[model samples]
Target chain A: MAYTVEGKGPSHIGIRMSNDAPPSHKEEARAQAEEALFGFWVFLMSDLIIFSMLFATYATMTHALAGGPGPKQLFDIHSAALETIALLLSSFTCGLATLYMRYDGSVKKTLLWFVVTLLLGAVFLSLELHDFIAMAAKGGVPSRSGWLSASWALIGTHGLHVTTGCIWLLIMFAQVAKFGLDPLVQTRFMRLALFWHFLDVVWIGIFSIVYLLGVIS
Target chain B: MSADPRRERRQELHGYIAGLCLALILSAIPFAAVMTGALPRAGIVWTIAIAALCQVMVHFRLFLHIDLSRSHRDDLQLILFSLLIVVLMVGGTLWVLGNQRAMMG
Candidate 1:
C-alpha cells in the first residue's frame, strides 16, 4: 500500500493506493489514527452539546439573583482577562507541541512545549479557583441564589474540564517519556490536542456570554 | 520526519503562528471593549459575542486543522452538523424558559 500526505493541518488525510494488497504497517497506522480522530471528534461534539445546555441554564438564571450580589458586583474584569490570556496562550502552546510532533518529530521539543502548555493551564486553573474562593467568601457561593448557582455551574464545569485536561497532559508527558513517538502515543497526543482546543472554545463562550455580557447587563 | 520538503514544513508551522496571533487579537478586542467602555453596553455585548463566534471558527480552521480543504471535508461537515444541533438546543432552551418566565410574571 502507498500513502500520500494530503493536508496542512494536524489531521492530515492519508490517501490509500487502489491496488488490492494487504495493508502495510504504515497504512494500518494511518487508518487507526484516522479512526481514533473521528471517534474523538464525536466525543468533543457531545461535549459541546453539554456545554450549550450549561450556557442555556446560565442565561435563564442570569436575573434570578434573589437579592444577592449580581454579576456586575462580583466579576472582576482584570482577573477574567488574566484567566483568558493564560488559557489562550496554553492553547497556542498546545498547537505548537502538536506541530513539533508532526513535522520535526522531536520528542524533546514536543515535550518542552507540552510542559509550557501545562504550566499555562495550571495558572489558569489556579486563578479560576481563586476567583471562586473569593466569591464564596463574599457570600457569593453557588447556593446563594439561582443566579450564583448557574454562574458557578457554568464556570465550574469548564474549570473541571481544565483540571482533567491538566491531568491528561501529565499522563501524556509520562507516555512520551516511556514510549517516545510511537503511533499509539502520537494518536493519544492528537486526541489530547483536540480536547485542549475544545476546552478553549468552551471558555470563549463562557467569557463572552457569561462574563462579558453579565458585566454589561 | 515528514516526507514533505523543508519549505512546506516551515509554511505549516507559520500557519499555527498566524492562528495564535489572530486568536490573541480577537480575545483582546472583547476585553478591551468591555473594560474601556468604548462601546455602549449593548453594543459591547453583541460585538463580543460575534467576535467569540469568529474566534471559534479560527480555532477550528487553524488550531484544530478542521478546514474546508478537500482532505478535511468530512470533519468540516461533522462540525457544521454539530453546530446546528447546538444552535437548536441553545435557542430552544432560551425560548421556552424565557416565555415561561414572562407568562408567570
Candidate 2:
C-alpha cells in the first residue's frame, strides 16, 4: 500500500519540497492580511448597497419640488465642482499614502501623504457644508420638499461617510505615530484607504447624477 | 519585498500619477460640457454618465487596487455581486415608483 504525504508528491515542487514543512511565517502573515482586507471589502460592499438605495430614493424625488427650490436654484455647480476636485485630490493622496506604506516603507513619506489627504478631505467637507448652508438660505431645507429631503438624505449620508473616513484617518495617523508601521497598523491603513476610495466612488455618483444632471436638466 | 522595491515603488507611483491625470481629465470633460452648455441636455447627460463611469473604474483600478488580475479576483467578484444587488434593488424601486406615478395620472 502506498500513501501520499501532502507535500511529498511530484506535484509538490519548489517551495513545498519538504513534506513536514509548515507554511512560512511570512506566508501565514500574507494569508492573514488577505483575509482581513477581503473582509473589509465585504463590509464596503454592504455600504455600497446602502448608498445605492439612497440614490434610488433621490431619483424618485428629483421632481417632487412641492413648491420649493429645485436643484437648479439650490445647487451652485461651481461650488460642487470645487468639492468634487477636493475629494478627488484627497483620494489620489490616499492612494499615495498606501503606496508609500507598501513600497517605500517610510513612515515620514506615508504620514506626509496622509496629512495631505486629510487636509483635502477637510476642504471637501467645508465646501459641502457651505453648499448646504447656501441651499438652506434659498429655502432648500429637507422639510421644504421631497426633492430637498431626498437630496439632503443622499448627500448627507455621503458626507457622513467622509466624516467617518476623516476621523479614521486621524486615528490611523496616531496609530502610525505610536506603533510605527507594524503589520496591524498597515492592515488598518489598508482598510482606511479602501474606505476613502469607496467614498470617492460614491461622490462620483453624487456629482454626476445629483449635481451635473440636476443643473443641466 | 521584491528583488527591487525601488522599481516597484516607481511603478506604483506611475500608476497613481496616471490614474490622477486620467481622473482629472474625465472630471473636467463633463463639468466643462455642462458649464459651457456646448452640448444638448441629453448629450451632456451621456457625457457625464460616461465620464463618471470611467473615473469610477480608475478609482477601482489604481486607487483601491482592484483589477481583473487573479490576485484581485475575489475582491472583483464581491464588487460585481454587490453591483448586481444594487441594480436589482434600485432598479426595482424606480420601476415600481415610476409605474405607480404613470398609473395615477
Candidate 3:
C-alpha cells in the first residue's frame, strides 16, 4: 500500500506514496504539472500577437526608404544568411533537447542539447547585433530612412524576442540545475521548447519575407 | 528504446532544404526576369507570391507540425484560421496603403 521508486538517491527521482496520503494531494500535483505547459502556450500566443503588430508596422514602412540607403543597399544577405542558418539549426537543437527531456531522461543529454541551442542562439544574436551596430556606425540610424527604420523595427523586434527566449532558456536551465528533469520541470521545459521553436519559425518568416526578400534585391 | 530523435530530424531537415530551394527558385526566377528586363516593374507580384509560399512551408513543417494524419486536424484548422486573418490583414494593408500612396502621388 505504500510506494517507492527503484532508487531514491536524488530528490529529482520520486514515487507517490498515496497509500497513506489522501487522493487529493496526488490530484493537486498532477494538475499543477499540466497547467504550466498550457499557461506557457498562452503566454507564447500573446507574445506572437504583439509580434504581429510589429510586423504590420514594419511592413507599412519597408518601402519608404526616403531615397537613402535602402534594403537592397544596406541589408547584407550574407550576414542575414549566417544569422538564419544559426537560428534555424538552433531550433532543431532545441527540439532535440525536448526529446531528450521527454524520452532520454538524462539530464546530461538534455543539458548538452540545451547548451547547443543556447550557443547557436547566442551566435545568431551577436551576429545580428553586430549588423545593427555596423549600420549605426555608418550613420544608418532609424530616423534616416523609413526602410532602415522598418528594418530596425522588424529585425530589432525579432532581436528582442530572441533575447527574451535566451533569458527563458537560462531560467529553465537554472530550474534544471535546482531540480534536474523532474516531472514539474519537464513540463515547464516542454513549454519553453515550444515557444523557442515558435520564435525560430517566426524568424524564418522574417528572413524570407522581411530580410531575404525585402533586403536582397 | 534508444531511438535518437536527431535521426528522424536529420531526414526532416531535407524538407527544410527543399523549402529553401523552392523559395530561392521562386525569388531567383523573378530576379533573372528583371535582370534580363523580361518583366515590368509591376511583375514584383511574383516575388511576393514566392515569399508567401516560403513562409507557408516554415509554418507547416517547422512550427505547427502538420502532416498527413487524423489527429493533425486541430493543427490544420488553426493554420487555416490564422491564414485567413493573415490574408485579410496583409491584403488589406497592401490594398489600402498602396491606394493611399497612389492617390498622394
Candidate 4:
C-alpha cells in the first residue's frame, strides 16, 4: 500500500522517485522535476501569445463579412455550450488523473481517469467538427469571407492543439502501462496535465470572444 | 503542501471541484445572457468579458495551482509578463485596425 514505487531491477531507475528517495536525493529529484515543470509553463505561455495574436486577428475581422454569413447565422450556441462542457469535464478528469498518479499512486485509477479524459476530449473535438460542418453548409466557409477566415484560423488552431493533446494522452497511456509510475512518466504526465488545462484556459477565451461575442454582437 | 498526504489530496480535490463549479457558473452566465436576450447589447458584452476574465483566473488559481504564495511567485510573474505581452499585442492590433477602418470610412 506504500505509494512509493521502487524500480523493479538493478538499473537504479527508482533512485529518482520524487517522494520516497533518501532526503538529499529526494530534494535533488524534486528540484529537477520542478525545473522541468517550470520550463513547460514557459512553453505554455508562449503558446498563449500565439493564441492571443489569433484572437486579435479574429477581432479585427469580425466586421469584414464580405456579404457572407456572420457569426449569428453561423454559430449555434447550444452546440458551443456542449463543446465547452465536454472540454471542461475533460480538464477536470485530467486533474483527477494527476491526483491518482501522484497521491494514490494507483495505476488503475490513474489510467481510468485518463481514459475518461481522452473520451471527453474526443467528444469536444467531434462537436467542434460538427459545428464547422454545419457552418460550411450555411455558406460560412473561410473562402467566403475575411471574418470566416479569421474565425477558422483561431478556432482551428485550438482544435488542432486539442487533437495533438488527445494523441499525447494515448501515448502517455501506453507509457504508463509499460513503465508503471516511474518518476519520468509522472513528470511527463504533469506536463500533459498542464497542456490540457492550458487548452481549457484558451477555450475560455474562444467561447467568450469568438462564439459568445460572435453570436451576441 | 500539508504534511499529511490525505489532507493534501483532499485539498487538491476540493480545488478542482471548486474550479469546475465556478467555471461552469461563469460559462452559463454569458451563454444565458446571450440566449435569453434579457440584457442590453452592452450588458451582454460586459457580462461575457467579465465572466471570461474571472473564469480564466479560476483556472489558474484552482486547476493550475497558482497563487500569490511565495513558492508560486515565479509562476505568477511569468503569467503577468505574458499578460502584458498579450495586452500590448492584442490591444495594439485593435487600436490600429479600428483607426484604419475609421479613416477609410
Best by lDDT: 4
Pull out the clashing pairs in model 2. none
| Backbone clashes, candidate 1 | 0
The candidates score, on chain A by TM-score, as follows 0.88, 0.88, 0.81, 0.91
Q: Candidate 3 lDDT, tens digit per residue, A99-207?
A: 5565457789889998999999999999998988888877778999876777788788788878988998899888888766766566666667777777776776676
| Residue-wise C-alpha lDDT for candidate 1, range B12-76, written one tens digit per residue | 67877888899899999999999899898778977898899899989888888886676567777
State candidate 2's DockQ.
Answer: 0.81
What pairs collide in candidate 1?
none
- Roughly what TM-score does model 3 have, to 2 decimal places? 0.73
Alpha-carbon runs more than 4 Å astray in model 3 = A1-39, B1-59, B62-64, B67-76
User: Candidate 2: where is the Cα deviation over 4 Å?
Assistant: A1-23, B1-4
The CAPRI classification for model 4 reads as: high
Q: Give the alpha carbon lDDT tens digit for every residue of A100-216 in model 4.
A: 888777889889999999999999999999999999999999899889999999999999999999999999988877777777788888899999999999999999999998987
Worst 10 residues of 2 chain B by lDDT: B1-10
Q: How do the residues B1-105 of candidate 4 rate in per-residue lDDT, one tens digit apiece?
A: 345778878988999999999999999999999999999999999999999999999999999989988767888899999999999999999999999999995
How does model 3 fare in lDDT? Answer: 0.65
User: By the lDDT metric, which is better: model 1 or model 3?
Assistant: 1
Which consecutive 10 residues in model 4 chain A have the weakest lDDT in total? A8-17
Candidate 3 chain A, run of 10 with poorest lDDT: A10-19
Q: What does the lDDT read for residue A183 in candidate 1?
A: 47
Model 4, position A153: C-alpha lDDT score = 95
lDDT of 2 by residue, A109-179 (tens): 88999999999999999999999999999988999998899999999999999999999999888777776
lDDT per prediction? Answer: 0.83, 0.85, 0.65, 0.88
Q: How far is candidate 2 from the true structure (C-alpha RMSD, Å)?
A: 7.3
A1-217: candidate 1 lDDT, tens digit per residue: 1223343232233222112224464465466567768889989999999998989999899879999998888898889999999999999999888777766678888899999999999999999999998888888999999999999999999999999999999988887777666545677788999999999989999999888888888
